[model samples]
Target: MTDVTLIFADLAGAAPLVMVLLGAAVFAMSRVSHDPRRMVRVLIAIGILLFVRLSFPLVIPLLLNDVIGAREVQVRVLWNALFYSVPNSIALGLLFWTIFDVGRARSAEEMTRA
Candidate 1:
């Protein structure tokens, strides 16, 4: 098989694992907040991962074309799709969390004023 195909296959196989981790992180953040610091750290880590993963599929093929040779085209396309979809999904989740947190804090502040 071509190198690109191999790269695509590897990412496809690994995507589900990443999804599981992301899902677990989301669930943990939503359900457990006894320790806000711990949850924040987890969210930050996941955010960074999401950012990095988003770039990989798009950047890898362009940067590694020489090394990837025959596999470049297919792998690049696959990476583009995977990176765009997965990381964006996670990023959206994180954004939603931030919005919710902000709303909660604002409500609490208003309650305190009352």
Candidate 2:
């Protein structure tokens, strides 16, 4: 395979390990009964963030090669900013909200040991 393919291959190869790590994170989060709803929100949002990151190297290259008209780097850049960055930013925002939840200080208090 070509070098470009190798690069994507590397990303694909590492995906399973990353997925396992994320799965462990989700499992750990599941054990937290103090704030199940918010904890799930945090995990789901983080998982989306990770999924988008993982899909990018594999999907964008393929899209540029066969599906999309634009070239690889340029189109992926614009697409990254549009499709990828948006959701990524939103995921981060949701994660922040789920963790802090300014309007729900009482819920945050449930997490305290005191």
Candidate 3:
């Protein structure tokens, strides 16, 4: 294998590690309280992960010549799907959360008014 191929394999090998870290970050963010600090952190983390995830497929092919490596091709495909799917799913989730939060806030206001 050429030097370039070695580098490509190295990066492809690391993709799973990056994805696992992203997943862990999301899981940790989900546990955070509704405080503004926590929310900001979560949003920032999500944004960064989303950007990276979206770009990974594009970068992967550039890093490798075959674009169909034995071990990592499936990962590339899955990430490509996830890159397209996550934004809409996350938007829906946030929308639901917002609706629930607003409803609760309004209910609390009504209780205070009573």
Candidate 4:
């Protein structure tokens, strides 16, 4: 394989990290008996995010081979359209929403305690 292929193959190096993310999602999901809706959203959004990240290395082979396109611009457009721009946006939004939700809940609890 070329150096380019080797470099792209390194993208899969994060596969273990993705597994950790999935495990965390499953653990968080186990604690959500009180809110089925939130649980579903969290699972779906995190699943999508994890799968997208996990599959990034799978696309590198196509990218190196010019199956998608030869030009860098075409590759950028494809990456943005297919993976980086839309799906990640929604996934990250959902992640932030979860964080915000937890912060708000904590704030409310502290207010009540005070």
Candidate 5:
């Protein structure tokens, strides 16, 4: 492997550790939270992130070779798209969910106070 590939492998190897740390933090926070459903959402988000992280190693190797057919190329393209889109979609979903959740909680607090 070249220097860049070695660096890439090292970084990829660390992805799981980062994910686990994130999971641990989420677990700790969820324990203190009153809403169990929030914990569920967070777990789901973490699962999605883990899936994307694990798929990273396979994606490059799977797409690196030459393709001889239109169908094969299309299939590879779809896999690449799926791999890339999943993480992005999860992130956007979490972003919106967090914003909406915070807004709803604030509104509820104000209503209760009033």
Candidate 6:
């Protein structure tokens, strides 16, 4: 890939990072029960993880270009893809589950308050 492509990728990553920062700020300002706060924290974590995970692929081309054999590059990319995908899927899934289950927590809180 050209340097121009790398520049574009870098530019693309900025917005998500900004959004994640904004989410962090919102999380800080939130006043909620412990369980709801936990859900917000998980959401913030997922956002940061997403920004890092998506931005990571850009590093490979810059780091490995002409540094190794094609076969080695393939192996590394495969390993990176596996390393990249599985953990992200697991984390994202769990975070989404937490977000979905927030209603249960809210309902329990309501029950206690009543």
Best by TM-score: 2
Tens-digit lDDT track of model 3 for 1-114 = 236666556668767866785786677577555445545545565565556555554565554446545357677667557655676467446545744665446456766765
**Candidate 2 residue 40 C-alpha distance from true site, Å:** 0.9
- Arrange candidates, best lDDT first: 2, 4, 1, 6, 5, 3
Rank candidates by TM-score, best first: 2, 4, 5, 6, 1, 3
Error of 5 at 74 (Å): 13
Q: Please give the CA lDDT of all the candidate structures.
A: 0.63, 0.71, 0.58, 0.69, 0.61, 0.62
lDDT of 4 at 107: 56
Worst ten in a row by lDDT for model 5: 62-71
Model 2: per-residue Cα lDDT over 1-114, one tens digit each: 125877677687878768875885667586667667777777777687677767766666566567665666676678657876787788888778876787766744665753
lDDT of candidate 5 over 1-114, digit per residue (tens):
124586478567867676785875577475745555665666666666665665555544444443322246677677667767868598659746954796446456766765
lDDT of 4 by residue, 61-92 (tens): 56655665545767666764765567778977
Superposed model 4: Cα runs more than 4 Å off: 1-8, 60-67, 73-82, 101-114
How well is each residue in 1-114 modelled by candidate 6, as lDDT tens digits? 538676566657667765775675467446434556665657665665665556655755554555543347677677668656776677677667766875665666777875
Among the numbered candidates, top lDDT falls to 2
Q: Model 3 off-target regions past 4 Å?
A: 1-54, 60-79, 107-114
Q: List the residue pairs that clash in candidate 4.
A: none
Each prediction's TM-score against the native? 0.42, 0.66, 0.30, 0.61, 0.51, 0.49
Worst 10 residues of 1 by lDDT: 63-72
| Model 3, TM vs. native | 0.30
TM-score winner, 3 or 5 = 5
Whole-model lDDT, model 2: 0.71
State residue 26's C-alpha deviation in candidate 6, in Å: 2.4
